[model samples]
Target: MVAIEFPLPRTTVPPKTGPILPDVLRSEWDKLRTVRSTYWTLFAAAATMIGLSAILCGIYVAQYAHLSAKDRALFDPASFSLTGSFLAQLAIGVLGVLVITSEYGSGMIRSTFAAVPQRLTVLAAKAAVFAAVTLVVTTAASLAAFSVGQMILSSKGIGVGLGAPGVLRTVIGTGLYLAVLGLLALSLGTIIRKTAGAIAAVFGLVLVLPTIAGLLPGSLSSVQKFLPSNAGLALVTGSHAGKTVPSLAPWIGFGVFCLYAVAALAVAGVILVRRDA
Candidate 1:
């Protein structure tokens, strides 16, 4: 007798999940928060701003009497305190690059793409989460540094209030600058997919290029204002006193700086979509 084979029961797969930007956002937020580098980098950035500002302001407090007229004229309590922002930018920028590159290095990117499938959405989520975090931390740090610096200056009878001209703008600008700077690094990391190279590219654009540009003729010095770092610094400082070259207005310079980051991210997006993981 021939036995008839029974048909196997069909298993229904729950339909694959639909696109949920918020879910992608939550997943990215979790990834960012779980990483040790996130905390360490944020701490370093804040500490540098607070510690360095205190020292600089303290020195000014001690030397106020002996400071030359030119020195006093060049001094900006807000700008001086936020000077640590320069160093902080380096830390955050490196952290941003690491945020993306670390995944590539550890082969986690494949898993990330496997889960998300939409590569651009993954990058956008990473960017939105990272940008929000950096903005909060850096903005708070900048404000604290400004407050501490101003308090020190107050002891010397030279402190200015938050309501003072450009004071608030400068403080807020520090955070904006850093947030965009980090975005730029993330974009570069996506394009290069290497930590060291991305970091080098960021610093070279922010720090090295300015120095190189300075070597050019004074007439071309105006061109330096377009560089990411210089434009950003101009936006935050809002002053050109004692400078050999003039910078654009605070908002204008910031707009220019943002364009640089936007350009890089736009390119990264195209590459991410068109190229293989």
Candidate 2:
């Protein structure tokens, strides 16, 4: 009898594996970079910051001789250089909102969630990617603005170097503030899930709340310092000798501002998990 040839059993090798967070981060980064809004918003932010800073510094230089003694004495070159941040924050906020909301608007978030399954991880990944990119871009923009503004102010022999007291901190803090502000907007976008509504909410938080807080009477007005915009701005403004309104210490104010973003993200995470996508 002839024996039948025995077949060899196939050996299966398991696919290589690694940490999930890194994969998620890479995916989120890809998504962020591919979007047209990312380029537009970032360009707008950088341009607004550099352009406005240059223009304002130039104006200050031209009018330096006409300024009052008190005004000149009280001027803060570092803070003034970063004034463009005021408008740049809006652009940053819009980009932040779009980072998530665009996916929601197009129903792509469902696919994203389906792939990740762990909704919080996806949110965290998005935040991580956005914060990293925003921090890099804004910090560069802040440095450029500071340099350009200082160059303009130097024409009048009033410019301070990065070595000056608080100058470096102010430059770095402007970027930090804007980065955190963008995170706040991203958190709001996650919560609202509507591009228009989330953007409006971000604008309201950054712009309207401050104005409303300012309008409050007497002791109530003190609450402004606790608001996210004011608190973050305190870090950028550094420490000034005289002010009609006093702000919290730099790091203290930044901590408060961070708390607001943390709280918003916490809420968004909960809602994302507990509710339908």
Candidate 3:
């Protein structure tokens, strides 16, 4: 039998082995930990939240005499002002977007895909890592902001306790909302694959559109109720947002926001699975 001649490959190679899921997760954890921005973002989240809270708490208590009777009776000012998360969420959303966008920006995504082969696994692992880390940190920041803020308020004789009805919901809800919103931004990053665009999308959703919606004529201000960020604000306030916006009960508004986040993440997952890295 004549031997068939074949072109030899240039380099000798051994068969590659794929990583187990646990190993992949550990690798991802290491990657997240090693990033300098991770620490900075966490610090900023805590600082901005606590700092704003302290400042607001001082103002509210010091100016107690200037406030109206209705403001004194219904205000959860401790929770309201301490919920710096309304702005701090920008940091969280940016962190989430960077989870995927950083790799794409730096050309590391190809290596990540090569190591995992199943690209979906990589995205899932990243989400798992991101959500886990964010939930813990955001929860801690929420608690710390609330505690410190209330201490200042109480010193001035104006604050509520967690045991008070609806207070716990506002504190915990802030954490949950931030975590979900971050994941939503992460999904957009996957879909858009560009950092600037992903950030703009988040800002547009949370800020620009809500302001624009309010500026429109009658019932459009009512229409702003459906927007995700504004909807989330309703979860914390027992009266302020409740009186003006078309809010469902607090938990119900949160549920609607959850639906928005999940749908965006699902669409991104499908695209990530089908697309080339």
Q: Pick by TM-score: which candidate is best?
A: 2
Candidate 2: regions farther than 4 A off: 1-16
Order of the predicted models by TM-score, top scorer first = 2, 1, 3
Residue 229 of model 2: what lDDT? 91
* lDDT tens digits, residue span 1-277, model 3: 9676677445666664676677778878988999988888777877888888888787878888898888777777546655688778889888888988999999899888887887767777888888888888987888888988888888757677888778888888778888888888889999999999999998888889888888878765677777888777667664453255466668778888888888888899899988888
Show the lowest summed lDDT stretch of 10 residues, model 2. Answer: 7-16
Task: Output the number of the lDDT-best candidate.
Answer: 2
Q: Which residue pairs clash within candidate 1?
A: none
Candidate 1, 1-277: lDDT as tens digits: 9776678555688665776788899999999999899999999999999999999999989989998888888877788889899899999999899989999999999999998888889999999999999999999999999999998999978888889888889899999999999999999999999899999998998889999888878688778878888887787888536666668789988898889888989999999888888
Superposition error at 248 for model 1 (Å): 1.1
Residues 1-277 of candidate 2 have per-residue lDDT tens digits of 9776668555586664877898899999999998899999999999999999899999999989999999999999988988899999999999999988998999999999888898899999999999999999999999999999999999998898999998899999988999999999999999998999999999999999999889999999999999999998888885665567758999999999999999999999999899888
TM-score of each: 0.92, 0.93, 0.88
lDDT of each: 0.89, 0.91, 0.81
